[model samples]
Every structure is written in C-alpha cells, then in structure tokens.
Target: MSDIATVVDLLTDALGADAVDVDPASLASASHDTWPVSTKWARQDEHPYPADVVARARTEQDVVAVLRVADETGIPVTPRALGSSVTGQPLPTRGGIVLDVSGLVGPHSIDEIDMTVTAPAGTNGGELEDALNAAGWTMRFSPQSLYRSSVGGWLATLATGQFSSRYGGVEDLVVGYRVVLADGEIAELTASPRAAMGPDLRRLFLGSEGTLGVITQVTYKILPLPADQRLQAFRVPDVPAGLAIMREQAAAGLRPFLLRFYDTDEARHAMADPGFDGPVLFVGTEGEPAVAAAEMGVLTEIAARHGATTLGPEPAAAWMGRRFDFSTVEKRLDTPGGFAETIEVAHTWRHIHGLYTDVKAALAPLADEVLVHFSHVYPQGTSMYLILLGQVADDAAATARLEEIWATAMRVCLDHGAELSHHHGGGLARSPYSRRSLGSAHRVLRRLKHALDPDALLNPGKLGL
Candidate 1:
C-alpha cells in the first residue's frame, strides 16, 4: 500500500476517527506557514495531506501513538501549540500529521514560596502572566508577539522580549520542561534552583526548532512586580549616532527595563512623520521610583551628548501601544498583490554597526524598499528587525524577489559574523543558510536527526530535516 493509505489506516485505528481531519480543505490551512513569499510556492508546494490525516493530540499517550505512526510510515510530523507561529513552524511538511497540542492546556498554577509556575506548553504566556500579576507577581519577559505567542513557541525560537535587558530570556527563566522526543520518548528537565549535573538537558530542546522534540510543559522562575515604572523616548540624527547612544548606555551600565532603537525609515512610518525628524530611541525603566528617576537621568544624559532630541511622556505611551502585534504588517501582505515581511538578526557590541551597514547594503538592491527597527535590548547586544515592502505582478516574480532578498540578508548577517537567527527559527526560508551559521555542526545535527528519527518523519522540510 502507498504511505498515504497505510498511514491513514493506522491513524484511524490509533486515534479513533474523531481526531483526524480527513477533509482536503481543513488540511490545506495546516500545511503552510505565514510567509507572503510562500504564496509563490503555493502551486508546487502543495503538501500532500499525510496518509491524509491531521491528529488532535492531547495526552502524552496520544503523542506517542502519533510518533509510532511517524516511525512506521517514514512520514513527517510537527507539533503545534497555541497556533501563533508566523514562520511555518507548526505547519506539517510532507504531511505525516499535525499533532495539535493546543487542547492540552493546564490550569494556572503558582507557588508563592518557590516563586515558580508549572504549566502545560499549551498555556498562553500573557494569560499566565495576568494571573500571576493579579497575585502580586510578574513575568518580566515580553516578546513583541506576547499577546498571541505561546510560551513554548517563544522558547522553541529562543525568543527575546521587550524587557530582555532586565529579565533575560525564556531560556534563563525556565528551570524545567516536559519534552516529547522525535522517537516518542518523554524527557523531563528536573526542577532545581541550579544544577552542576552535566550539560543542561533542558537547553537541548530550548531552541531545537521542533526538529529534536515537542515541548509539552514548562516550569519557570518568577520575579516580583516593581514598585515604580517609567518609559522615555529620544530621537537621534542618524543610524550611527543612535547606535552610539545605545553603546554609551551599555558602557555606563544603565540597564533600563526596555532599551530599543529604531532607524529613520521605521521611525517615520511609526510616528506619522511628525517632522521632528530623526531616528528614535526608547527606554523603559521600572523599580523603586527613586531608582527609576536615576536611570532616566543617565539615559537622557547620554542622548544629549549624541545630539538626540527628547520626546516627552506622550511618545513613550504611543510606542508602548504598538510594541507587539507586528503581524499587522501581514494585513498588507494579504492585499493580493502586496508583500511585507521582517527579518531579525543579532551580534555582539563590537560588530553592531558593521552588521547593520552590511544588512542594508545587501537587501536594499533586492527590495523595492527596506526598513530596519531595533527592539528587545540586552547586555550582550541588540536584535536588528528588517521590514520589506514590495508589490509584485505575479507569483513567479514574487518568488524571485523573495529568494534574492532572503539570500542577500543571510549573506550580510553571516559576513559580519552575527548569529543567523536571534529569536525566530530558520523555518524553510531560513534553513538554506543554516549551513552558513551552523557549519560542520549542521552535519552533526542531521546525524542526530537520523539517529532519533531515521525515517525523517518529523517536521521534514524545516531546518532541512
């Protein structure tokens, strides 16, 4: 029998008829990720509905059953949590099955003594944080996707948040996890304040891109809500001057709750061209009111030396309003012939200016127009987020343009010696350049995939697995 027929039979018997989405229509939406560029691939990339089945997985046993079918049929499968991914990470490539775990959400549970929360991967970060904050606690991490993005996807992509300069990231805050491996084995990261025991097994799947495993649950350390908070804004003459202001703040060790920089193009679009006219810097400070005031002075002082103009409280509130929900740009992409997207890359303090210069140099020629914005500050460095706007006549030309821009952007990041991805996974679009950043380690990663899932039955097209 063909793999499709064989796998369908197994899924029906294993999961019962209720869990499968046999309709060709329902499965189509599950097959593609959110890339305007992928509209180009829509014709050739018609992913076959796996053995013609989509599994609604809930319990651990259900996941294991799905994996058994994956290994038996040599078809691929990818797990889904909260369904908030922009990059097609949750979409099943080669169509073995989309093991949807959104139904397995756990009840909000918090431990006041230990200051930790244990919950299923299906849980939403914003929802969990709301509950915690009501009880006089807080989750410092706030990725731009916070409103809709889940804790699991954020951790899977090594996501950084708006307050990354203070709270660190999902990896540093998470102390434990329940991960289901590709071969159906379940591994739990032991709960501990800290461990000297071997390498952190928790980190193994932290940013593994759903290729290594599917995370089922997470337990994280929590911090107390601050007594005071403040957000401030500054405008710089140009890119170099804006970056210099950031470096000066970092050098002085004034780590604000939020430290973000936006280029002129991004600033103009965001501020409705007020004509005050310059790149913008935003810093959020929170803690004791006295301490918040001190940090604000430090930030304002640094900007003055660099010729940056000050915008008072009103602009800061405006920036905070649209800090997340970047997916609005996708609305433009949805306009039949319109296309828009963003790319984020990271590097250390020394290479920051050079990386920014090269990335624009590479992508500008390919795109009709390119805009860069900075958010999610950290002691190590910043994340450069790129936005592209293009209008294409047909699928063929759109594909060519996307390919060119993605390639040029990847080259610029690598040539300047920055990590290919700061938060987002390589997805199918980013996988080709994985070799550039990962090198020989990429080969070993493939080997690990073979050992754990020799059938290549898990998220097949992503990260080149």
Candidate 2:
C-alpha cells in the first residue's frame, strides 16, 4: 500500500471513516486560500499546495486525536476554518493532513454580568454578533469577512475588524482561548481584566498563525450596543491633511467607532458618488448620545481646521452599507489575466506618509491601479491598506507581477520602518520577510516555536517558523 494510504488507514482507525477524507475533490479544495498569487497559479492548473488527506474534526477530542496521530506519523497538519485567509495561512504547503475544525460548532454562551462571550472555534462571526445584538450587547468586532470568517480563524490570523479603532483588534477582544498543543495536550489560557502574571501566554498564540497550536475555543469581551450612532464624511485636499485630522482627533481622545480616510481613487470607488471627489474621510461615532455628539463636534472642528469640505453623512452611510461586499475584488480576479490584492501595513505618524508615498510609487508601475486608505486609527499611528489591481498576458506573468508588487511593497515598508502586516498574520506570502520584519524579535519567535512544536508539525511553512 502507498504511504499516504497507510496514513489514511491509521487516521480512519483512530477517528472513524466518516471523519477522515481522502477524496480528490476535498484535497483540491483544501489546497489554497484567497491569496491572489495562489489563485492565479490555481487558474493555470498548478496546485502547489495540496494536502494528502483531510481530517474533519468536530470536537476538541477530534483535534487532539488528529494532532497525536500526525505527531506520531511525522505528518504536517494545517488547521483550517472557513478558508477565508487571504495570506494562505490554511494552505497545507507540504503534503500531509488538513485539519478542518469548521464542523466543531458548539453552543455559544454570553455573560451579561461579565460582559463576555465564550464560543466554540467554529462559531460564525455574524451569528455571534447577531446573538449579542439580540441580547442588547455587541461583539464590536466587525471585520469585512465577518459573515464568512470563523472565530478561530480570526484568532489564528490576529485579525483586526473594521471598527478596530474603538474595540481594538482581535488580540484586544480575545480575553482568552483554549488551544490544543502539538502533542495533543489541551491548554487553556485565561485572565481577568488585569493579570499580574509573569508572562501573557495568550499573546504568544495570538498571531502565531497556527504554527504553534490549534485554537479550539475563544472568550471575547463585549459591550452593550451603542445607544446612538453618528456618521459623517468630509473631503480633504490629500492623504497628509486627512491623516493630520485623524491624528488630531485621536490625540484629543475622540474615540470614533469608525475612522476611514480614503484616497481620491478609493474614495471615488467607495463612495460611488461622483460629486464627492478628492480624499474622503468617513468617521462614525457611537455611544451615549451626549458622548457621540461631543466626539463628532470635535471631529468636525478638526476636519475643518485641515481644510476639509463637509460631504454630509451620505458617503459615510454608503460605505457602511457596502463595507462587507467583496464583489469588486472577486470580479477583478475572475477577469482573464487579471489579479488584485490588498497589502496592509502600519507605521507611526512620523513615517506613515513616507511609507505611503514610497510604497505607492514602487507599486505604481506594476499594477493597473494602486489605491490606498487609512483605518484602524490610534493615537500613535494608523494602518494603511494598499490595494493593487493588474492584468498580465498569462498566468506566469501575472504571478511574477504579483510577486514584484509584494516584494516592492514590503521593501518600501521595511525601509520606511513600518510594520510588514498590520492585522493579517504572516502566512506563506509574508513568511519570506517575517524575519526581516521582526528583526531580533524573530529569534524569540523561533525559540517559542521550537519549544511548543519541536517537530514543527503544526501548520508548517508559515510565519517564518
């Protein structure tokens, strides 16, 4: 019998025939993620990422058993859920096993008193949010992929939602989680609002990208639904002026649930209102009516100081209504010889403009369109999202051009002293620059990876680990 068949037999014996899948279709589907390079390659009939088998784990015990067997057999296991990763984090680069936890759906419990929600890894983001909303509470974590992404996937990628400026990123929302280690041992990390613990172990796994273990369950902090919400839009002269307004508002302690600064091109595309031109800033404030009103007043003053033209709430409202729609990207990718991708990086106010200008200039020649926006604002800095779309003669040219864009963008970011990835965890696409991005800190990650996964069986070839 073949080695893979032998492994399948062992897995079937350990779990059950129903849980182990070796079908060609399943393997092919598990091969890649939403990464544009991977998608382009896939269109060319090149499946560089294919797992030998799949383990549809439905419980924590199933995860443990699969990990134990994979360890014993020295097989790489890539934990996946929802398959919404844009960085190929779930793609099994080495032929081994794809551990799918999408079926591990369990009852989610919300604690009104504690202001927290505990959910299984497979819990859908939208469902969880709806449940919280029905209970007069809000998850406050609204990623663009909320309807499609799983909780575990969010934690795995250390994602930041659209309203991160107010609620913070996934790391801030996640109070704790239960993870299964490489040796099939289950470990739970939990803490109160403030823990004087020696080291925050929860952080180690936050952005590990599943290179260390499998996150099985998560506990996230929630808040009462905002009593009032106010949306406002403004047109600024350019990115720098818009950024200054954002910085001033943030520094003055105005906490808006949503603060988005879109460049001219992105503004035109996002607003879809020809009357609104130039850089557009969409700001939303939500809370007690008094507090929301006060924040908006200060925000408007700041925008005016920066020479912004008030565009009313229509543009902001429009963006909010269609924020989750990814049809444009899907349509672009489906076009013949066309490809598109978004690279998000972060930097302090001091170097953000330089990073933006350099990266845009670097990528302009390689892409048909280069658009940018600033969101997830903070007092210290903000995250920039660079969108690139291009067409090539063939798959080979497309792949090459895509790689060039990534390489140039990363190089410019590094040169400008910006974070390589703001929210998306370093998967295969970003793995090459992981070490450079982390500098000496990369050694610390390596040590942790070695300590946790001695054999590197958990999601191999990711995060530069």
Best by TM-score: 2
Reference-based TM-score of each model: 0.92, 0.98
Show model 2 residue runs off by greater than 4 Å. Answer: 274-276
Count of clashes, each model = 2, 0
lDDT of 2 by residue, 194-300 (tens): 68778988887888888999999999999998999999999899989999998998899888999999999788787886565599999999999999999998899
* Pairs in clash, predicted candidate 1: 50-95, 76-457
Clashing pairs in 2: none
Per-residue C-alpha lDDT of model 1 across residues 1-465, encoded as one tens digit per residue: 246777778887888888777687667666655655554455445553332467877666788888877877677787776655655677665666787776667686788889888887777888888888888898787877776777777777777777877777788788788878777888888647888788766777766677878877788888788999888788788988887787778778887887778887778776657464668887888899999999988889889999987887667778778777565566656655566767888887778888888788777776667888776566667778888888777556666777777888887787788887777777767877787688888898888778766766677777766
Q: What would the TM-score be for candidate 1 when compared with the true structure? A: 0.92
On the 0 to 100 scale, the lDDT of residue 5 in model 1 is: 71
**Alpha-carbon RMSD to native, per candidate:** 2.5, 1.4
Cα lDDT of all candidates, in order?
A: 0.75, 0.89
* Position 89, candidate 2: lDDT: 90
